[model samples]
Target: MANYINPMEPEIKYNIALLYFNEGRDEDAIKILKECIKLKDNIIKYHRTLGVVYLTNGKHDEGIKEVRTAFKLNENDILTLNNAGCYYAIYTNDLHRAYYNLKKAADGITSNTDEYTKNVIKKNYNDIKLVINKIEKGKPNDSIKVPDLRLLY
Candidate 1:
């Protein structure tokens, strides 16, 4: 007998990983997502999911690196920009870069963006605006946490 593989196998695995992630099975999701990346490293969604998994699982640096890789692969990708913004804002406390990337993503929204994604970008942009306002007022925003960008997926 010959082994058979479906071209959509990676996508299938990616979706399964997503289900696992949403169910709070981070380790299982991570494993499947890593396998998906190994199969199709160019898919930004896989990297994004994996990066979020790493970040939420206390592997901040690794998560940032993976998200950065996705950004490098496609800077104009709304999802990548959103993730980059959230990562910088939340983990690194780099408000400037966060605002820039988030603003870019919000402004770059086109017809290709689904209504849900457009809404997510808008909400994130508004959230960042509030943060910027608070920062400008010398108000401590240490209590404000970045919204999970993964939820937009």
Candidate 2:
């Protein structure tokens, strides 16, 4: 096994976990991710991906916890900020926090930022801004719709 040959390579386990997540094997992914984290707790990707996996599996609190850990590890990471925004928007309906995260990510973009990541962050920020504007214009809370991230290829 690759892990047996390179037992210290947490990335190997992390990559396997990502593959399992893409295959919808959430429990398997979680198992390996936890192992990966135990091997190397400081990797932001491990925590971020684990957060996403937990959210997709409806483990809201655990997902938030992982994301919070990632944020603490690197608050300036645009990807983490964008994901935090989307996750809070979709799961917690905490528009304020979501908008803050997305705004930070959008503002942090530079020439080095890839087009796909820029578009995704901008789209999420604009979607949240629209909802906030609607609320500011006296729209009822019942009329507010959570932002959705779909078809962003």
Candidate 3:
């Protein structure tokens, strides 16, 4: 509703993009993502969310590329890693990358010891562990530990 670009605070630009996305306005989200790039080009979240926007719009390749860059920047980002992995695993059906990212997510969650965090991880961990068993069982061919972040978000 207001101007997407703030005069300062580069991170807010990303939030604006997210607000656009949460509002179900993909075009506005794209515009804000581009603006975020202009303000601070190195933020991985902007690209990650941009990828999500593109993916939601059915531009899977563009989404994958952008989200992959985000993954490169932050391997532990549940959003980018899981999204890219799922795109590769389910959509494109690239089992290796899918297993890698999903495992990374599952492992990352397990690595945190806080009870609250563990409980949080426990839920998704259980789901992702299913995928892990698939990968460890000498088969990336299964869809078990798919790393769904819908619950996390």
Candidate 4:
């Protein structure tokens, strides 16, 4: 028989990856997400998902590269902005970029944004701001840790 394929298979794989991620199976999620990306390379969500999996698995560079590619593909995506902000803050320790991206995500929220999502974005924005304030005040003893919110997706 000839090879059979479903056009919706990529989405199925993406959903499966998400399920694995929620179960804390980062490795399995990474595998499925990679397959999904291979089948649908143009989809930003696939890249973003894979990036998040990599980051959570401690593959920092790979995660940043994937997320950066997604950002390049669609800078206006709030998820991309949030992921970039979290990645920069936690992994690269680039506070400026993290703040900028998180602020952009927060500012991008609109009427279409659900209340829960709006709260999450605002909370993250405020948390980053607090960290920035402490840093600026030369509070070297204060260490701020940004939460990895990617899994909440």
Candidate 5:
């Protein structure tokens, strides 16, 4: 069997990737995520996050591939579905993929959590739901007159 390192080491690398991402250095973020992948090959979060970084940098196909790989590791992840949907909607403009992911996200069951598991509830889920509602209901005719609710949160 391969030797095991502390999982936290790879987690730290993942955090560094997020820092680089926030600094607007997408290339650096990708590098750190890749390193994290080698260290913790089974960590799906690293793959998904790296895919998002790629998407932000306009590497749509690569981003989709990476996120899909992550999903293969964990098929029940709502975040991955949302990320894939956003990539399809915003980057590829592939309404079909967007619809599929958004539908999955909207219908997926989530665990109920108490105080100790508070991380279960996040706004991203809500955001995806809103987008799905928009698509299903059709856009407002006066799009410009509508509020930019995206910045609301």
Candidate 6:
């Protein structure tokens, strides 16, 4: 196994964490992600995935912290922007921040981006736009229901 050969490799650990996460093993994913970060903190995916894991598990504070850290590591990364946008919108109720990030991400999409990714970003952007419109038209924020935030692999 790659992990067996490179036990200390951050990517290997990160991949393992992702596998655990996909398998619905949040605790195991978190543990491995933390270890991967300890092994190499600068890698953005480690923090991003960890943040997503935490957010999905209802650890809002921890998830937000990790997402912020990932942004600090690479603010221009489209995936980071998307994640932050969704996290801010869904968890923090910071529609302004969410709109900003989602807009940037949507605009930054290039030809290299896959169709699924473009669709995801567009959907998030549209959802945020709807929410913003409702608020501008004097709808109560709590009354407006936003859909789940989609994450990029």
lDDT of each: 0.83, 0.84, 0.68, 0.82, 0.67, 0.89
Candidate number that wins on lDDT, 2 or 3: 2
TM-score-better candidate, 1 vs 4:
4
Candidate 5 clashing pairs, residues 3+ apart or interchain: none
Q: Candidate 2: lDDT of 111?
A: 100
Count the clashes in each prediction.
0, 0, 2, 0, 0, 0
| Candidate 4 local Cα displacement, residue 103, angstroms | 0.6
Q: How close is candidate 2 to the true structure, as a TM-score?
A: 0.88
For all predictions, the C-alpha RMSD in Å is 3.5, 3.2, 5.4, 3.6, 6.2, 2.6
By summed lDDT, the worst window of 10 consecutive residues in model 5 runs over: 144-153
Clash count for candidate 2 is 0
Model 1 misplaced regions, further than 4 Å = 1-8, 139-151
Candidate 1 per-residue lDDT over residues 1-153, each given as its tens digit = 998767559988888999999999999999999999899899888888799889888899889888888887888888778878888888888988989989998988998889888998888878888878877776554566555553244
Query: Which of 1 and 3 is the better model by lDDT?
Result: 1
- Residue-level lDDT tens digits of model 6 in 11-82: 888889989999999999999999999988998988998998998999999998998899999988788899
Candidate 2 local lDDT, 88-108, one digit each (tens)? 788878898889999999999
Quick one: best TM-score, which candidate? Answer: 6
Residue 50, model 5: Cα distance from true site in angstroms: 0.4
Clashes of 4: 0
Minimum summed lDDT over a 10-residue window in model 4 is located at: 144-153
State the local distance difference test value for candidate 6: 0.89
